[model samples]
Target: MPVLLDLRGAKSSDVAVGTSPISELQACLHSLAEPDHHLESRPWLTGIGESMSPGLGHRLTRFAPLWARRRCRLLLPLSPPLDVDMATELDRVSRLPENDFVAAAAYAVQGGSFDPRGAVTRPGEFVAACEARSFSRGELARSLIDDPGDFRRVLVRTLEDSVDAFFAKEWERIHGRLRDEVEQTRSRLRGLPLAEVLSSVSPAARPVRDGRAVRFDKLQNLTVPLGGNPVFLVPTIHGRPHLIIRGEPGFPVVLHYPVAWRGQPPSIDEVRQRLTILSDPARLSLCRHMVNEAITTSDLARRTGMTRPQVSRHLAKLRSAGLLTSERSGRYVYHRMDVHHLMGIGVELLRVIVR
Candidate 1:
């Protein structure tokens, strides 16, 4: 379903940019499914799944006795990514006067609002001793009933190990590049209006209500419509082919989108050059014809009344600008419109110009 942003009551100051390592890690774990539904290509996760089920953590019964059941119930809900993190966002959940260490995990298990600026979270307390699938939610709640801090460490140790084993080496370069992208994303947000930012968030994000409301339809059967709460746009390098959204009646909405810098939003100078390529009528014509139809370069050349080599040159320029993405099928390569990159470039250039 779609997460509806209520732009009727929103202001320019209503939206902000935030970061969360915890959320990123959660996204990584969620992507470990065998089906690979939410990610584009996760070979590493596929390898891991071949040996173990992505749900193996929830069913850690073989390792511990009663600990198995309680931990299983609790971990599954927590496995669903949170918009906040353990370091910066944990304390806010506990509602403790000084922001205690155990608060975040407890709050998550208990379910409630998280406070950075009074950000309310959806309640995950449904498993409160409620029995389902031969498991008790109360048992899960009891797992954290005694010492939340110690329980947290136990959870972290395994999570950290699992993540480090798969992503540690890749994260150095990935994290560094994502940091740069986040910085640039913030700059662009500050430079442009909120509407423009949403327009360029992702291909799946469609603006509604005259560019005031943007419908983010990333997940199926999810419907979250906000009224007066502020929104946060948190982009990540690893979050691709998926969008994470969380909002409550009284708190801010957060949109965690993908922005992995793989030649997207090319350098400022390069983007300026790329923009000029769009001015060519021939290239624009090719783009229109290829919007929903994947055609071969030779066919595009014929349709555009250009020689095969000439069409190839135009397509190359468009691809460099990140407007077109291609895939090879045996001998012939087919190309289609990169709607996300194309719209993103629009906002990027607008930011450069308006600034």
Candidate 2:
């Protein structure tokens, strides 16, 4: 399936680069909820987990599914300014109508497909319909349908608590980097066609229909007509493994793309360290074995005729180099290669060498 963005009437002015703290905040929550897919942000995730109050932690866990793999669209600002801050965005969310909030939450709970009218007019029938599809977040959905006001209050409070606890500092630390990405993108737009820039944004994007539209290779089939509304390109550090596209009716489409390393190429020393780590034959062999499937150290040792200690030593080197991610299951820990990081090594090395 693919998502097509029709740009027939769109011009250079219709595409803009901007940063939204609300979107970044949602991205951060998604990364925290699904940490296994974002191994690069493990340190930040661990730090936030340790620092958050127990009550906040419990609330976040309760609402994890709302922002985990599919975020509630209402959490994102409808049309954020280029210099939008957290307070302004939160204010936007705090003012959403009860019906609109319920509809958006139901859409998220139903996995991006739901009837807003049904959610608003026929709440019981809507929940029944969701249950027919094996509703996983029934309680949250019910909370939204039965008492949207309370849900909205709790949602706002939880988000505010998140910002106060850690994201305010996180935003301050990364705001400059995000602003730089936006400026660089704007500069590129001055020279390149919008289609070319769209293709360059992600490997999964391609200019289609003779550049009249951009198609993203995604899981859902959707055709979004720009209709002269501006397209906002938001770059985020914590939005990896997910290129978020929110195209609600009557609002500008938002694309939250993943950016590597604060939008800068890795340093020479960083590239050198990774290359050096992968240069060892034992470690290379271990990586090869773990490329397609995660393998336990004991299993890898048995398959390679190496002792457990030797396999562990090699795995540690790969892990330290950011080339491997591990997950513990029962008594054994499974390690897998970080293919994206591995592929970026060559890009980083080339940039360093050429620059």
Candidate 3:
């Protein structure tokens, strides 16, 4: 079941791109909040995550389910095609009606494991909300339930503190550069047809069944039909598995695409250099042997029956080609083969031809 955007009659103008301070904060919290995620968006964020006050960071982790990769659906106030008055928008969300708020809270189940206890008031409403999205639901009346007591207030307070303490200053500096990227993205789509523009949104997005629909990569692939409504492209520098597409079986979808799309064609020099490095038998043997364990220059020379100087020269060439990685142990260096890069070379070759 694909959620089609139905942008068929839409012009390029119909596509909106903008910033959401709310989303930026949310993204930051998600990206920088945990250590397990391999925070690739900002190297410095990894350090920041380590340096954050232990208690404050631990408190934020309690709400991890709400903003992690399988995040909450109740992000309208902070979601894109952003408002000019972002602060005011969040304020309005604080007043969301009781049932709607409950529904929002209910939709945030993780991996089909719906914890009804997490739903404070009207557990049945929460159960129903989960059921509506095709997640399994059941009677929650018997379970001990707690009062929600204005979820919005708690949400606003904690997020504000986290954003201020961790993200505010950094976001101010990052906001402008991302806006320029949006403009540049829009500028490139000026003369292209809507279908081409849609396909180019990301490397993973493809126009399947001609131009009638587009499919994007997800847990399961999502197909979105397009009508001339509107689609928002939210650009960011976040790594893979942060929020990407945000469509809920409806129109006016938001796609969180990367600003600097990473699947670029391999440079000619890189291709030539790596291939050249692999062409020599001694170098090839060295690469093959290093896969199982890191070998010192002297050890590699003894294994290959080559002089230490010769082995060292081959290692230097392989390192420059990114086929080898080296680590120092006092006076000697150990070389390890990057088998992963070797496997990925096929992808680079294909990209050169297709991208």
Which candidate leads the pack in lDDT?
A: 2
* Model 1 Cα lDDT, one tens digit per residue, 1-355: 5566656766667666655555565555545532234334467666755665445555322223222111112221222233343443433332333223333333333332233211122223333322232244345445554445555556656555555555456455566666666677678778876667776766556678787777764433445554456666766655554555665333456677777434443334665787798889998899998888899999998888899999999889888777888999999999999887777766555433321
Global lDDT of each candidate = 0.55, 0.79, 0.61
Which of the two candidates, 2 or 3, achieves a greater TM-score against the reference? 2
Q: Judged by lDDT against the true structure, how good is candidate 3? A: 0.61
Lowest summed lDDT across 10 adjacent residues in model 1 is found at 68-77
Once fitted onto the true fold, the runs of candidate 1 whose alpha carbons sit more than 4 angstroms away are 46-153, 160-168, 218-230, 249-251, 260-355
In order, how many clashes per candidate? Answer: 4, 0, 12
Worst 10 residues of 3 by lDDT: 136-145
**Each candidate's root-mean-square deviation in Å?**
11.9, 10.7, 8.6
Better of 1 and 3 by TM-score: 3
TM-score list, all predictions? 0.51, 0.73, 0.64
What does candidate 3 score on TM? 0.64
Model 2 segments more than 4 A misplaced:
129-136, 261-355
Query: Candidate 3 residues 1-355, lDDT tens each?
Result: 3334455666777777776666566666667644345324557776677778886686566555556545454554333346354466566557655555554555454324455334555566555554555432222211112334444566667776766676777777877878887787677678766666666665545676576566654444455544555677776654333335665533356676555544543554577678877999998899888999998988998888999999989988988877888999999888899888888676555433322
Q: Output the TM-score of candidate 1.
A: 0.51
